[model samples]
Target chain A: MKPIFLLRLLVIAGFIGFVEALCRIGIIDNFTMPPPSRIAADLARALASGKFNGPIRATLLNAALAFCLAVTVGITAAVVIHRLAALRTSLDPFFATYYAVPVLAFYPLLIILFGLGSAPKVIIAFMLGVVAVIVNTLNGLDRVPRVLLKSARMARMGWFATATQITLPSAAPFVLTGVKFAVAYALIGIIGSEFIMSTDGIGFEIAFAYNNFDNATMYPLIVLVMIISIIVNMLLSIWEKQLLERRGLR
Target chain B: MSLTRIEILGPILVSVALLAIWQCAYWLIGDIALRSPGQTVRFAGELLSRPTFWPHLVETAKAFVAALAIASLLGLTIGLLLGLGKTAGDVFEPMLIALYSIPKVTLYPILLLSFGLGLSAKIAFGALHGFIPVALFTMNAARNVRPIFLKTGRVMKLSRWDVVRKIVFPAALPEIFTGLRVGFSLTMIGTVLGEMFASQRGLGYLLMNAIGLHHVDVIMAVTLMLVLFAAVISFALLAIDRHLHKRF
Candidate 1:
């Protein structure tokens, strides 16, 4: 690592150590806020016992499935809508309402419709992801240069051919941006579903720990989720940077 | 009619058609789990007449406003600090990003345990949700301040404060407003989520209660209220955004 990177890491470590020291010195009660050391130990125990793997697997599977479903539906809908200008215009309000509505508020309705299993969780995740994807894909399609479309038309390219050759390539970045948003939303939605009504998952574990007043366990579980999210986001950023470089647009 | 009027009317027609379809589908479903438009509206009317509804609404609104106020103050302070120093910005950016990406729903457990199922917990959660976007955007906007503008201000012998006030502030206003808009929405969402998880009162708790009791109509009514609240807040923010964008 570069010196700057090392220095940054040290700074973070120092901050954590300072907080830990404060808790140890009775300045901050562990009951109210457990120290980093306590949380780390709890995390180690959880890992050693393999207590977290199942929950992580379930949550990740739900997120992945929901993301794929949303993207598939979103892209197809975007393409169809883009092909018909009138339909796009007419659908604007519906889309706006969908975007604006807090889909979580409909969790009760979803649970009723889909039952208290993985189905509702997946559906919730899909609901959170799909609207953003659709809107972003539409925006991306709209951004395709008029000149390029005209050229494609002049070459007598078919609709499907033009879409595949021109529209998809031009829209890929924006679609990816949508996918990034969807990934976060899917995680939130899935975790939230688990929190509200699941028998198992990271959310369930956190809730269980809270009910038991096990601050050490609760804090570490929360920290673990935060670390996973940060890692995922960093990977997405790297992927985005590579894509931007290839397009020579960043 | 003019094109603009047609544009407006087209959406309204589509919305009505969609509502009609929903009502018809609900009618076909015909269960407590599925409520028709008429039933939903009736339930909402009934809720409006109930004495508890106002207080619940007020409590949620109060929590929302309090959270927003605290978030704005703290977010602005942190944003300014990070924005003013490149070293500070670089050091903290990753941490902010990490915190932002975390599914904060999980943190409700910790927050509830520490703060209890009270207004404080909700406010803290909302602040956490709102702070990241504000800080990130403000830092970016500050960093992107045109060098020529800064140089001109410096050559004119303006103080650092003067330069920030007269040039950097206005230049960054649009981005700051965008961040505020996003932050406000997230704050509202976070506050509601917090309430849902542990609160004794508020729309979230009420909705959960209704769900537990299998009162789908009441749940629908509460959902509609939430939708309206979100719409109103967003439109208000959007108007403010546009005005600031134009002014600056």
Candidate 2:
């Protein structure tokens, strides 16, 4: 298992090196496409110079807030819909095609309604992520076997106790999986909103650089965004694994 | 899959209620840019009456369909190859996951540089959006094909094509279809994003134009068109999904 993981790392590193060499030798244009080495060096300089810290921190803070809002609102809605058959029946179809909709279309409305700055962007992120959380939450709850509920009642476990000990734990893995998705979606939403309109944050940086035709700066910012995504995904996956293991789901 | 009268009425009633709320919001906001549902209907009516709307809609549609075709073809072929071979799946799965994690939008500039701000770039961007999910789903669906079915085919001395066609494809169709559906959605998103970022034609381009001119009605109209398109496609896919489930 470890060897295979190492091999994967080696393959990626080799691919990067190959690309770097290709660009250096002019097989791939170095002007439009910066070599991986230059990008890496720029990334390190950006880090060391503390030029990116502000934007990274801002985006992270916003994404975190959006994620929390999405989870809270999503779970609340999911629980409500689950308890009300009519609402579930009415809304399920909408939820099914939610991702298909260019949710950014609604961003202009959000800006008009929610006011400017980060509020609209945060809401955009929340809007993008909330559906997945809601759907997965309901699915997790639904999979909490009816037999378990019956047994809980038979054991005279109170509603709160049963929910805490059985329902939540049983549903944790699925919910966590939803969280993994929510994080990604939320980040994507935030960046996209920023790309469309914003003064600061990583998305804004990328857009700013591109608009100025500052390819040197733009390339690194793009890498930064990718790294941020990879890091977030890795963290969430690890967290998900831990939760699944604790629940004996893995 | 058959809906009762109540179930059918449920969504319709909810939509009407939402529209009513939308109109109420319009009243409260008192903004022409943010028009009432009735006004939106009128706006759509007016726009559709014009000759310009058709071309923009067609451009978007053309790019969308072309992207889906390319993504579906490539996704399925590559997915099948990877799924049919465990060694290939194991080697590439991690890398694919990594690539998928990075939002494809980030790479749009490079695509613009490579393909230029043309139909090809938009289609390529949309194809990239669709490809990952479709391929991922197809690979998993193919890999998860029951070993017993394959063994039975082998025991019966079936050829490779026969085993795949008779045993694997049918079993994986449901999940593969799910990927295709998701791919459609992403394709829609990608095409729109490409148009918004940089393009000469399409609803996305129109929307961006409207944004610049503060033609909020047109923005709203374009959004409504996209949403309507999504709903129609989703319902059609749902019907097909049900049929496939029943037939298979």
Candidate 3:
């Protein structure tokens, strides 16, 4: 494990060094991209400058809101749908094909309805993420052991009590999987919508900088977004692994 | 209704129900920004009949096909190589996942800078969006091939290419195909998105153009067409995917 980890680090550092050499030697060119060292410097300056604080906060806040909404609404919808055999059966195809559909295509319509504010972006993120949560939660619910439910019933547990005590605990890992996807989707939705048409957010800032040939700002923001997303994803993955291990499900 | 009957009727019922809701929304919004389902269908027909629409459609199709081709070929090769290396696969899989989850649209500027504002850029962006999933799926598929099968090939003294062709390739084909299906959808999206942001042609460009013009009818029409195209192709691919999964 340690050897593999060291190898991964070496690979990453080597790639960055290669890029740095390219930029320094005019192979990639400064207009196209900056060197890793330059990008790091710019990132530090940007972070300390406080110029991007507003957009960063806005994007993160909206993404968080979207994630929360998707998880709550998705789990609720899945629970309801799980109890209704006909509805679940009828919705199967929709769920299967849902991700294939470009939910972003509806962004224009959302803007029309909600105006050019953060609402549209949040809605898009929620729409993109909620389905994954629903589908995974439903899968988890379906796999809950019937014997466990029977024991709960024997213990005189009510439906809500049984769910909170037995069903949810058993299904936590799968739900975490859904939550993980939701995190990615929410960020994608918020950033993608901002990229397409919005006045603010990190995506808009990048686009704005790009149009003006401000590679300094654009590259650093791009790097920043990459860092934030990768960190969030890694954290969630760690938690998910721990949860699975605890449940002996890994 | 019976299960089979419900299976046949379910999607259609859902479609109709959705259209009804859409029509109701149109009635409520009253045409300043919305189009009724009937109106959207008729407008889409009109747009399809127009010669101007064909160029955009053709451009998008060309980009999508090119991107999917590159993504599949390259992704499969890389994934196969990594999967063959146990340590390499373990080290790189998480990196690939991180790449997969990042909001790739933000990288459009870098693509635009390197590839420029053209078909190449669009194809590159589409391929970037598509390549990871295919690679990830293919890696797992190849890595999971039963060791006994390879052992038998080794005992038989089969050549490397022959072993792969006769055993590993066939064993991994089903899952690889699933990867292709997903890669196909994402490529379409990425190509369209590329057009939306950078290009002067394609259905995505048309959608963006319509938004700028506030041509609500055209927006609805193009969106309707894209959704129909995606849903039909996805269902077809899903059917094949299910068949393969079941057969294996």
The candidate that wins on TM-score is: 3
Q: Model 3, residue B5: what's the lDDT?
A: 77
Q: Rank candidates, TM-score, best first.
A: 3, 2, 1
Query: Model 1, A1-250: lDDT tens per residue?
Result: 3766887899989999999999899888877788888788988898889978999899899889998999899888899988887778877756654544567777877777767888988898898888889899999999888999999999999999998898988889888888887888788888887887677888888888887888877888888888887788888878977887898879
Tens digit per residue, CA lDDT, model 2, B72-129: 9988877888899887788788767877766667788778777877999999999998
Per-residue lDDT over B1-248 for candidate 3, one digit per residue giving the tens place of the 0 to 100 score: 13587787876888889988999998898889999999999999999899989999999999999999999998898888888789889889888988999999999999999988899999999999888889998999889999999999999999988987898889998899899989988988898888878679998888878777789998888888888898899999999998898899
| lDDT for position A174 in model 3 | 94
Give a tens-digit lDDT track for model 2, residues A24-87.
8998886578899898898888889998899989988999999999998887777668878988
Report RMSD (Å) for each prediction in the order shown: 2.5, 2.3, 1.5
lDDT, candidate 3, A24-76, per-residue tens: 99999898999999999999999999999999999999999999999999998
Error of 3 at B196 (Å): 1.5
The parts of candidate 3 lying over 4 Å away from their true place are B1-3
Query: What Cα-based lDDT does every candidate model obtain?
Result: 0.82, 0.84, 0.91
Backbone clashes in model 2, listed as residue pairs: none
Each prediction's TM-score against the native?
A: 0.92, 0.93, 0.98
What TM-score does structure 3 among the candidates reach? 0.98
The candidate that achieves the highest DockQ relative to the unseen native structure: 3
